[model samples]
Target: MEHDTSLITTIAAGFGLALILGFIAERLKIPALVGYLLAGIAMGPSTPGFVADVDIASQLSEIGVMLLMFGVGLHFSLDDLLAVKRIALPGAVVQMGLATGLGMLIASWWGWDFGTGLVFGLSLSCASTVVLLKALESRGILETMNGRIAVGWLVVEDLATVLILVLLPSFAGILGGTVAPTEETVPLWRTIGQTLLEVSAFIALMLIGGRRILPWLLWQVASIGSRELFTLSVIAAAISVAYSAAALFNVSFALGAFFAGMVMRESEFSHRAAQESLPLRDAFSVLFFVSVGMLFDPQILMEKPMHVLSVVAIIIVGKSIAAMGLVLTFRYPLNTALVVAASLAQIGEFSFILAGLGMSLGLLSSEGMDLVLAGALISIALNPFVFAAVNPIINWVLQRSELARRLEHREDPFAELPLTTERKYLEGQVVLVGYGRVGRRIARELDKRKIPYVVAEQNRELVEDLRKKGVAAVSGNAADPAVLIQAHIAGAAMLVIATPETLNVRQIAEIARTLNSDIEIVLRTHSEDESQFLQKEKIGTVFFGEEELAKGMTNHILQRFAP
Candidate 1:
């Protein structure tokens, strides 16, 4: 009559410890994720007492991954990925290569074999999508341009990792893995082509069929007015698609769930679906962090202190510096570079998964795996501090380094309006800052009424496109007084701040006011508190939240520009 209660005990202990420690972490102004990891470590075998089943904990964490990715998909669309592809795609690929190279260097220095070095290096290359998502969401910047770029970059990393996971098994012998050697050479390109085919098929199906069917299904279920059923349906779709994708298409569970969520987003009730499923998503996500913590063997830190430090340095310092440099090279601003770098500083689920595969293939020793786990734990715990340092570091660099200031505010060929710009746009016109969704809408409204405007956008590429289309736009952060002057703010009838970039909006507004005392100003904000603060400071007309805010801002600008 006896039965195993391992699952129940694992969840109970994990959640209980996570809650207590997480609360303490928050009270101490630390990230709750660090607390969750600590909770896992407490219940792990290495800690000695009442060890939770690591296998069961890992499975539970997978469910969390499925849900967390699904939620991200509900918000992230294909267009969002496309929006940052110019930066994210190249940035992720180059940064991963750099991290891998660094990993290989460290491995070689430690006298590891080539195969072991390759696997170890790759294990450090990818950033955890879950961790990046959590960081962006907590900062209330998940919908911003920078957030999209970071998430898109991680998406590319995940895709690349999935390809590596698939191909690594085929090259097991060459990589010194456990697979027995055969006379036949491993068909490397064949396997890669097959993987691409399967991946393409899965995506096509999700985009074409799943998009139509899932939304319809959600609609049918919601029409029934059963909250329980709707929630069940959403979770069922997430796990089912994830499992099926793994079984049928050789896709990662997280990627499968993400596609499922994206498809479901086409439905009218996508927001409701996200709302109803949040509790489960959050709960499972905690378990994911806990399970990650459980895998750590703290002994590695003590046994090979220098080795552990080296791994941490490669992951936190080496990878971050490389990624930041890549971002800057791509012509992204300093803040984007710093944020992207901070986002890449921690390795998570994929590292553990890759290391496990390495062990099975005999390419990595248990010692190497231990080092990876140690690095993951320490880096993840410190990731919050790294992110917190971004703004301060940016400020410090800008103030202290001439080169850094140029990187922050540099504008060149497209920084100034061309000499041929119409006099109407240079004077008695609206200075439109940002060309994102709100900015686009404002521009369209102005175009309809023939109200001349010039755009000041941080994205140089966007500005280039705008210019090609005969729009008067300058590329640079508006917080730079020179950028404002370039936009002819002194003669501008009104200034419309449309993008929610993390720049000094107040400073930009003050500069605009200083340049043109008679100019009117309008600003868009996502936070009500920020809107209130802006209004109190008389920093133009501040609109808060969503499309309505955009509409109101557009209407106000139109009224001022009315003939």
Candidate 2:
């Protein structure tokens, strides 16, 4: 009369523990991911409680990895990557090299062979995409220049890790590791060529064919008027492409799903697709973090305390210093350098994959894997703190060091607009903040009406383009007093903020009001809470996107009924 309850028990334990711990973590002002990992630890074999099937958990985690990468691809902007390539590409490479070197040195000192050291080093080189995205999104900066740079940097690291994963087995002999007899032995150049060809073919196929086919498939599903079917199609597409990539091209699920999302993003229904698939993506992402926790053996913390410490130092300190130095050397602002540094100060899924692979190849020992897990656990738990410390630490350093102050205050000529001789353009004009999707539309309307307005945009390139078009534009955060002054906010008739930056909207409004008390202010926000708060405070004329959309739809329906 008894039923096989293994799957149900595993699901119940995972979801139940994760929900409790995630809520606690949120209450404690830590990221819910930390809680999810803790839940995994609690239910893991490493702990005393119920042990979920490690094999099942691992498989679930693969789905999590695929979905997480797919979500990242949905938001991936080629323009953003190109915007930060001058720094992100080289900076990521250099930072990873430095971090890897630190790991290798530590491993060598521990008497591990060259192969173990190399594997250990490689595992520590990349940051967790999930952690980075969560941090950036919480801060409402995922669309900012700093966020774009961090994302681009992670993308570079991901690509590098993928290449390493592909090449590792071929080098097992030289690395003092044993490869499976079934493993194909090819010349190094041939392996490299083959890998590149496969990747190129996949990319080409996705970009050319998948872009058209996937969207068409989604459209067909939607036309059937079944929400369940649409969601199923999106999930099926993600998993199917991921499986095919691994089965046919020898590509990782992460890369395959990323390409799928990227191609899907080209469709007009991208937003709808993202919204529909978000719940599944988030659930799997949680499972991914939980599975990571299951691999962690707390015994390593006590047994090899110094080794764990050394790894954590490399992840948090060594990597951060390397990234900050590279960013500053590139003449980016101190804020940007600190943000990028904080973002890279943790490792996650890729580290686990590398460590497992290394162990399977007899390159990394169980002890080494434990150490990597220990470091990942600690570093991830501390990542939110690291991000929280960025501004305060920068302020503290600037306060004590004259050089630091100078660096913070230094302005990049390329990022700032030159003052114009004509004062008429500034006086009695509307000051528009941001130059993104919404701002662009607003600017177009303003331009067509021949309204005198100046744009204050953070994207220097966008500002440059505006200037080229004979429009008055200033390049800087509108929240900054100097930028507002440059934009002539004091004399502006109206101020419009066309970005969903709820974090700084209040400050920007305050600064604008102080500069021109009579200036009419309009602000856009995606959050109902923010809109209500702004309105309650009399901050400005706040527009909630969803509310406006609802109102527009209601009005259209009412008109139809009236006719």
Candidate 3:
């Protein structure tokens, strides 16, 4: 009797529900992504009591996707992208091809049209830039080789998505006119050519115009120093370019947003734009995930369960292989390669956009839509678990074969390359690899003896603190050649590799030995087995702390007995 709930009201209700679920997800130590999906399922058309307006939700999600992509572009400088070209370009192309091919094969097995299958394949080929990055960052792996490669690969995937968005509609339109429901003939080739031309021209214009005018516009805006005005202008530019892409050039709004971000990245206002837009981006991005979740009809998984499961399996295997192969080929550690591959084994937000486009163009059926939605939700929900398994899987692989043996090999062709042009410092000094309890104690003892020493510690903060106390410290991994050089290992009287007693310690010790053949090497370990391992390397000294602890305990017991 109060009033009818309009679509807007329904969307608002769905959004509120999503926010609550997201909060719940965070509290439960689960990925917030799961919460967003659960929120969608609760308010979806298939659910009772709170049916959402799917159309409105989808539109809002479009904005969310753009903002998210814009953020990615803002953080990723062109220089960084070019630097990782060895992995970013080839890895992405291979990964996409493999995933898409697997998708097509799976879809074909299910008897779907070849074109529909191809579209579905293409959808599965993409790894979500947002999801993978968030997972890696949360796990504190963003600076590792795995993290770097995954980010580069995702960037490649994003570029592919832009091109696909540019051409998808025309391709579908052509296929549509060629098939049934074409009462009038349409020139497919010319239409496609014109669409491609328009898109290419727009890209060229943005590249040139963005490089020239955007910086100037941003500078002009900055000169005013009005926060409100600057924020308004940035949003206006984002929306204006997005609107133009959709209205004038017939491009996807997301593409325009990406281009706008790329332009904004070059401006001085980049950091401010990123900071200001985050609140809005988060609000919309949450809605997007929630909306995506709402599209999940779990019942469809029961109906077309095999098809969904098959596609998901293909995505995991295909994407993993593509990522791992590329990362390893580019000479990242094997452990890092495995982590990178596993992290990207799921489908992403862009996949949904492709499916949505397919649906609009009649290339996807209701069943196909449901299948895609279910796969996306399941993959996103399970991403944390997949990521968590990376280390364990790597450990297992390390025990299996020679391939794993070489994973930690630091004998790369550039191992001997020195970092600085200046002659080595720390001549006749000792190089200490770690600064842990044993390592640090040893360094102090050496200092008391007046033996000059350099500390090479991976903990950057600890290295800084040491330097402030008038210590010579090199900030980086002991296993890295650059760190050794920075500490002047070649000019040292001795090398002490005191890292944790892990498998990689052997590699570090070997590297130190290779760098200075005449320099004496000492190792500190907690176990007799570790002592034996170091002995095999003919280390000058091996201190087994646990054995000493055991002997002290025995002495105390005997003294008590004699007393």
Candidate 4:
């Protein structure tokens, strides 16, 4: 007997093409997302190939969306946002406004209605969180100060987008579009008020009840000691909460899943949850991109090339300029401004979601959706190159303009130590780089042992605190030769780099070696492969955190079983 195999065929074809093209993309030094999108295009009806069922692909995509948001929530840190709130909050809001305004102007030029312009503009405002994080991670800067600010800025944008998703349906009539007409149209204020109330109630429930129940549920499942069961529980919680929120409270699935992951973060099992669920989350995420590909009409590129270019400019140029201006206005260093701007110069998953919602509500036309997708494809494809160009661009500008050089070299009193007769602590001492978690512990142990050491930290506040406590400290990136000079690396006995910035470790090591050829060097890394490479190059004593932890645990167990 023959059986219906449409679902199986769709899954097989989607994953197969995605795998092949994704590998090719990586080999070509591009993000695998580009490959996934290409795969989807190949299987889409627009490409005249084996078209997967759009409806089935869409359902799978929804699951992917929920899982993707869940993973994001797991990594979301309130502390990180609060750390950069002074810059992130206002910067995100202002930058988003500028991008939106540009988008609206372009839409108006194209003769679209105000509602369509609003939706299109909002879609162009936010950067893709996935793409940004990946870029930062690859560069080993995700833990840097600028990275934190960028992540925090994106969080603000995400929250704003969630609010828009909630209120869009309510204001559908006023926006000059309606998915479905109501018996009597509700006043705009009334609709907004109702949405706020329901959202508040749902948020309260998640924070208050979910905080207690979800952890308890995970704890119970974990006690069963079954990995499969634990993974199932995580998936279930994400999907159930997301579906219930939409069904009962009229909240978006993305918002619901985000909250679920946030609440789950309070659990001791949060790391395990993230680790186990990653494979599944990643699988679904690919499907989500694939489904997005299916919706694109490639003729938009040929039919409206100028419109596409305008949208791309809004995303890449307009948004970037706004972010850079905001960061500079906040008195951040030019390096920080450049990094943040580069990070936000691409659009991704959230843009697609907003476009789809607008289209469903009749607030955005097919042409608008196509333009958004086209803009996303081009911008995402170019983001890495944009980041790669930041340093070169900054260098070129500095060399050409004295004003640029002055701005880049502007002194921060807090970040520089005055040269004086206090020279005793700067000689024959350990120069410890970074003042973060690992550096702090090392400092404390040295203090307890009465060892002379000087801290070279990037955070001015941290350096100030160290000095107040009578510890020798200088503030600036260790990778800077001047900062190393300030730390008296030439006279120092050793250099201990406690930061996990893999990309800069080699530079710091080389600088220290150049200054003091016989200085003992120690470094830390998160990747075993990186550690092996460093060790092979004789870059100094290297430590991989996980490997060290395993060794320590083994010693403890061996001691327990001692003969």
lDDT of 2 by residue, 35-125 (tens): 8988888988989968998888888888998898788778777877766677889999999899989999999898988889999999999
Q: Kindly list the per-residue Cα lDDT of model 1 for residues 1-563, writing each as its tens digit.
A: 99999999999999999999999988876667778888998999889888999999989988987887788778876676677788989989988998999999989999999999999999999888767888888876676667878998988887688678766766776566676555136576775677778888999999899999999999999999999999999999999999999999978787799889989999999999999999999899899889877877788888899999999999999998998898888777788888888999999878877887788789989789888888887888788889999999999889899999888764578888899998999989999988888899999999999999999986677788889999999987788899999999999999999887634788988899999999999988877777778789888887778656679899999999999
Deviation (Å) of 561 in candidate 3 = 75
Return the TM-score for each candidate structure. 0.88, 0.88, 0.74, 0.88
List per-prediction Cα lDDT, in the order shown.
0.86, 0.85, 0.75, 0.88
Which window of 10 residues has the lowest lDDT sum in candidate 3?
413-422
Which stretches of model 1 miss by more than 4 angstroms?
Answer: 133-148, 179-193, 333-335, 360-362, 395-400, 501-503, 544-563
Residue-by-residue lDDT tens digits, candidate 4, 228-314: 999999999999999999999989898899999999999999999999999999999999999898888899999999999999988
- Deviation in angstroms for 8 in model 4? 3.2
How much does each candidate deviate from the true structure in C-alpha RMSD?
Answer: 4.5, 3.2, 12.9, 3.4
Q: For model 3, which pairs clash? A: 40-294
Count of steric clashes across candidates, in order: 2, 0, 1, 0
Residues 408-452, candidate 3, lDDT per residue (tens digit)?
453443333234422333688888877866777888898798888
Evaluate model 4: give its lDDT: 0.88
Give candidate 1's error at residue 7 in angstroms: 1.6
lDDT of 1: 0.86
